[model samples]
Target: MSKKALYIRHKAQPGKREEVKRIWEKYARAYIEDADGQIAYVYGFDDTDPDAIVAYQFYDGEAGKEDFVKQPWYPDYERETAALLAGPSEFRTITPQWIKGGAA
Candidate 1:
């Protein structure tokens, strides 16, 4: 299957969800907003898990994701995020064969 979307579920260390959100807002938000081929990007806290942050991104194509790690702010964002995370994130690749509207 061809993948055009990504979902990341990350659980922050207890009481560190705010730090994780700040890191994304300070770094990743601008990059995603300006990135080429990015169709949509959104993130928020999990309804049942106060320590969890979930992110969903829709790309125009697979090539759209190539620059994520290459961005200048990526290192700082990654380091800060990793420090606050309870553990490794869960990545879910999606095949967008039935997309209908913009992401929330």
Candidate 2:
């Protein structure tokens, strides 16, 4: 089966870029240990805007993506970070058309 990917674009509230990065790092560590369906998680700050951050998570497949959303920590993560966000996060689910070099 083909892998699935989730893309998230987040804008941090004023002066919250560092906090957002720290929280995301904590979340990534937890996800690495416990996310069964996740293949990888990548995150970074936007090039043009330091307050904007982007994250991507690769899954085994669409079902894996579904399973991820159902995980107990999902809602908690969303709620915990919601207050630090300048607005709602932009989310997108994508199918990999081509991949090269790296494992992703």
Candidate 3:
């Protein structure tokens, strides 16, 4: 079964949104190009609320995600961005029984 992750981020701080995006961009290459099971990724900010950004990322399976997260760069990315973020971020794992998009 294929698995996916839905990540929602809300930036409570007024001036930190740009920084948040920069961090994501810094790690984008590694996460998308090199990470295991990473099928696709889409991210954007709310028009009415720029402080809010939603990311939809799909992985091949649970094991792939686990392996990806364990990569050295993953922790480095997390640690560097931890202070730039606001409150707790949310992560939802989903089993994509059927996906309409093309495969990665």
Q: Report the poorest 10 consecutive residues by lDDT, candidate 1.
A: 95-104
lDDT for model 2, please: 0.79
RMSD to true structure for each model, in Å: 3.1, 2.5, 2.8
Question: Which regions in candidate 3 have their CA more than 4 angstroms from the true location?
Answer: 10-12, 101-104
Which candidate leads the pack in TM-score? 1
Which residue pairs of candidate 3 clash? Answer: none
lDDT of 3 by residue, 37-88 (tens): 7777777786887566677777776766677567677777777667776777
Q: lDDT of model 2 at residue 45?
A: 87
Whole-model Cα lDDT of every candidate shown, in order: 0.85, 0.79, 0.69
Q: Lowest-scoring 10 consecutive residues by lDDT in candidate 3?
A: 4-13
Q: TM-score ranking from best to worst?
A: 1, 2, 3
TM-scores of the models, in the given order?
0.89, 0.80, 0.76
Instruction: For candidate 2, write residues 1-104 as lDDT tens digits.
Output: 67888999999998798887787666555765577777777888898997899989888877766765676776866777888999989999888877675443
Better of 1 and 2 by lDDT: 1
Clashes of each: 0, 0, 0
